[model samples]
Target chain A: MLINHPLLGPRDAAEFTCFGDASLLLRPDPGPNGEPDQAAMDAFHDYLHLRDNPAGTHQELWYHEQGDRSWLVVTRDTINHSIIKVELARNVKARNLKTREGAG
Target chain B: MRYSVFSILNQALRGNTGWKPVWREPEPRPAYDIIIVGGGGHGLATAYYLSNVYGITNVAVLEKGYLGSGNIGRNTTIIRSNYLLDGNEPFYEMSLKLWEGLEQDFNYNAMVSQRGVLNLYHSDGQRDAYARRGNAMILNGADAELIDQDRVRAMYPFLDFDNGRFPIQGGLLQRRGGSVRHDGVAWGYARGADSRGVDIIQHCEVQGFIMEGGTCVGVETSRGPIRANRVGVAAAGSSSRVMEQAGMRLPIESHVLQAFVSEGLKPIIPGVITYGAGHFYISQSDKGGLVFGGDIDGYNSYAQRGNLPILEHVCEGGMALMPAIGKARMVRSWGGIMDMSMDGSPIIDRTPIDGLYLNAGWCYGGFKATPASGYCFAHLLATGEPHDNAAAYRLDRFRSGAVIDEKGSGAQPNLH
Candidate 1:
């Protein structure tokens, strides 16, 4: 499998390592002081454990370990392994944070 | 009729024409006392034990396809109880015990070969870890022996003992651990359940759960809606998709695990041997093919096929361990989806939904845990209590901060 890297064209998937679901980017916050409450604990548990392992399309995190050392959010089909889009995880995180702030 | 030496001789004398079908093709009934989703090994075994041990004969096993089409036949059929954690060792030991007498108990030739399983240690640190693991297995009433380098060489001298990178230091051996005919297990259990008046319904895909108020009462299948007093889902790889219809999320990711088989050779490998440095394990089947596999594809996939990267990676591991395998040509390779659970351990417990039970998260280890998984799931479904051996496999354990992480990978499904 070849993952199209945003920085360097398409690269062999062996050069990159996968970290499963892209939801790991949205890690739950414990608190301002890093001391978690009961709700925070539950949020952290679900954040780390539960997954929407869909059968069709999936957005996942992939690291260009052997090349650029950049994390990329790759939207791909789980059934056929066809990559639809790839972007830097930093941009995706920024966009998500902006969307969350806009919602509030 | 009961299969025996007399039966074989009687059939042989009559020109071998009077053998009946092992299981019947039964249509779905409107309702049953219990409904088991997924007619894989664990599902069939659950139905068999429910009727044989628990005497609950009003059961129906619904299959999306033909039986044994899942990981039950896809795994590199090795079974062992060499575990370090308390939560896992006892449960797998129970499975090993069940495997010991499975063929006779099911009255079928499952070919349960107790030729032993060896996990080779490559370095001093790995040897120490194996020693600790072997001790834990011994404490759990399972046999484990930490053998020296000389003993390992004596048993299998073809190993790359002098290789600079991964010199064989020693190994942890489970004398009773070995392989079984994988599909025979499914057939045996299906036949056993069918003889007990349980219906084996094939091509009956469960589309969704029939929820009456807050409790699950039945399932809508490809055939029709069937009601049940209780429902147990033993779906291995499709656990996430199957349970999603019931409005539940599991701590599982489906990944494709591929297995390979080489062309027929003479009887070489005596038992199962695992490469400690890499994720490769191999055994010689009775048909003389070398059966082997490595890690999952490391990505979530419901595709029952894998990519070339993992296949090449598995061959590299095999070549690194046994260089002689490089000369053999790989004949066939296939993939099965694995329900990889966070913390690398399985969950066999009641779901939040009432009257609905789950037996999933076997990951790639589902093949070895088939018997105990079924027995424990059956026990839970019948008595509404977790089996003593499986008490630690609760779904709420994750929420309570008590995950049974055998690999200590910390919520990473693929790493396990």
Candidate 2:
């Protein structure tokens, strides 16, 4: 409901967080069409995920008000909650979207 | 607020049990202002709307069989407005609104259970699709949310969480989707309409159209010929055949869909869950049994009975998804032939023939669509114009190759 849409909540659009793991950017979604400069940010981007963040290195959280019962995929900064990318769960789905954070 | 859609629909069914005759032919009326064949939910609903809303009281509903004994009785009652396309989204949302207030409107209960429906996704691509659907649901003012495996586990703790052939990835939750008593909806409308002086003609099997020149003047039925200015064919399975006899060939497929219920399983499934990736869904009835169903027999069939394939396929899907349900014994299963359209959507528009109306091709989603279907069909019959959403379900869409199929996988309901 905010013009800037800063505060993400349960009723807003989906918010996905990815911390560090940037492999998703390289994994050819648009295939040959998405020719990223071959040099992009592979550095750790703080992401927020409730429990299990799909990848081993990427820790993240996803929230979606406009999503199938499944949370849509999102790329955001974990520290500041700054959203980077938002994708449908189908687009970035890898097994389950999350698991519980173990002993870490 | 005290009652949901399913709760409302169920109460109506209980109040009007056996209010209608099993089978009787129709008597020829000198001039019935309106005649609606097939006393299913749609027919009864149309009659009620015409009398109450449009002030058209000289309505006559001619039914070949008992009321609600067709698609109304055989359908697996699942309702939601989570449509991705323009054609289905709004119409279904409208239907949901009608469903929300049917109890107070009819002064009868239809016991609509707003337990919410979940469409599960197995892969990331499917997750993305659900994400979009969730957005569409919210945009359309439907209650929806997306949940992951851990959340699903918290919600449905009894489910088998072990990873398998298709592990639980995520699901699109439609908090507004749910179930209703199928028969209650039909009889409630029938009684409500009958109270308004609308003639209820049962056992009146529509034989042919008594066309005067190019207009539909009346209908020739098994009992006798009845003259009517406005004729609506709401016959479920016989929709295509009735249209064909009327000199029109429609793009309708007469296919049978079945529903199943297992012997009481101690309240397992709390709500309705439709597997988006799988072709099965199960919900626990109030009696502790699991009332469930799956996709139809892929081929076209008019038989009231279905083959073993659908039953087996549904059971397998259920078992694969919910491992604990394996022990539950299949109690009973029944089939109802639906007027499956070229596209999985419905066709609720006026026919080319003047004064002749068509309200068929609901496919498997009719139960959820009953109230809206009736509302839209009534508007079309009264004003002789398509309701806002019926514009998409034009009969010519089939000819034009413009199908508004929702299950983009193209498997239609059969593949669902």
Candidate 3:
């Protein structure tokens, strides 16, 4: 499988190290006072352990270890090794924050 | 028919045509007392124990494919009770004990081999860790021996002991640990359950749960709806998908674990040997092929095949352990989907949903845990209580901060 990096065209998947679900990017917040109450602990536990774990399309984090050293958010099919899209994780995080702010 | 010397002799005298199918291809009934999902080793064993021990013969084991089609037929076939944790040691030791008398108990020739399993340690720190684990095993009533480099060499002289990098210093041996015929386990359990009037239904895919309010009453299958008083899901890799149908989300990720077999050669490795420096375990099959495997492809995937990187990594580990293995041509390789849990341990307990039970999150170790997993799961279904051996395997442990993480790799499925 070749991951089409945003900076580098298409690199071998072996050159990249996968760090599982992109959901790890959205870690849960402890609270305003940073005290881990029951609700905060529950959210953190779910965030750490629970997963969608779908069999179809998945957005996962992949590091270009042997390549340009860029962390890319690769949208790939879990059933077949097909790369749908790849983008910079920083841009994805920024967009996520913007969406959350807009919703708030 | 009872499988014995008399049965073999009688079949031989009758020109070998008197043999019948070991299990029946029965149609699904309208209802059963209990329904077990996934006809893998664990599911079949659960049915076998339910009938033989619990007297719950009105059970049905539903399978998407044929029996033993999952990791039951895909693993490296190594069995051991060399666990370090208090939560996991007793459970696996129970499974190992069941494995010892499994063939005789089920009346089938499973070829259960009791050759020892050795885990080699390279560094002084590693040796100390193995010593601690050995003590833990002994405390848990399982046999363990910490052997030095010379003893390890005496057992297998072909090892790269004096190599510059990752030199073998010592090993932890479990004398009773070994391998079993993987498919024979599934077949024996299926036959045992079938003989006791349990329905073993193949090609019966469970589409969704027949839920009434918040309670699970039955299942909607590919054939039709089959009602049951209680439902136990023993699906290993497909746990998340199967439970999702019941409006439940599990802390599981499906990852592909690959295994390989080399061309048939003379017996060299007497028992299962593991490289502690790297992730590789190997054993010689009865058919002379060297069966071995390493870590799972560290990613969430439903694909039942792994990548070339892990394959190369496994071979490299094998070569590092024993250079002689570099000459053996790998004849076949296959992959199994593993249901990686957050705690790196299994869950065998009642789900929050009424009349629903879960026996999943076996990860890559489901094959070895088959008999005990079945026995405990059947106990739960029959008596509505977690068996003493599997009492700690609660579904709510993650929320309760009681995760039984043997590797101490918290919440990382791939790392486990």
* TM-scores of all predicted structures: 0.97, 0.74, 0.97
Could you give candidate 3's per-residue lDDT for residues B1-416 as a string of tens digits?
A: 99899999999999999999999999999999999999999999999999999999999999999999998998988899999988899999999999999999999999999999999999999999999999999999999999999999999999999878899998999999999999999999999999999999999999999989899999999999999999999999899999999888898888889999999999999989999888999999999999999988877787888889889999999999999998999999998989988877899999989999999999888888999999999999999999999999999998888889798653353353
Candidate 1 vs candidate 2: the TM-score winner is 1
List chain B TM-scores, each candidate: 0.98, 0.91, 0.98
Residues A1-104, candidate 1: write the lDDT tens digits: 78888779999988888898998898877965899988898888888788888989899999888889999999989998889999999999999888878985
Tens digit of per-residue lDDT, candidate 2, span B51-138: 8888888889987777777888887777788888878888889989888888788766788888888788888999998888878877
lDDT (Cα, 0-100) at B84 in candidate 2: 83
Residue B263: error of model 1 in Å?
Answer: 0.6
Judged by DockQ cut-offs, the docking class of candidate 1 is: medium
**Candidate 1 structure quality by residue, lDDT tens digits, B254-296:** 9889999999999999989999999999999999999999888
Segments of candidate 2 deviating more than 4 angstroms: A1-104, B1-28, B408-416
> How does each model score on lDDT?
0.91, 0.70, 0.91
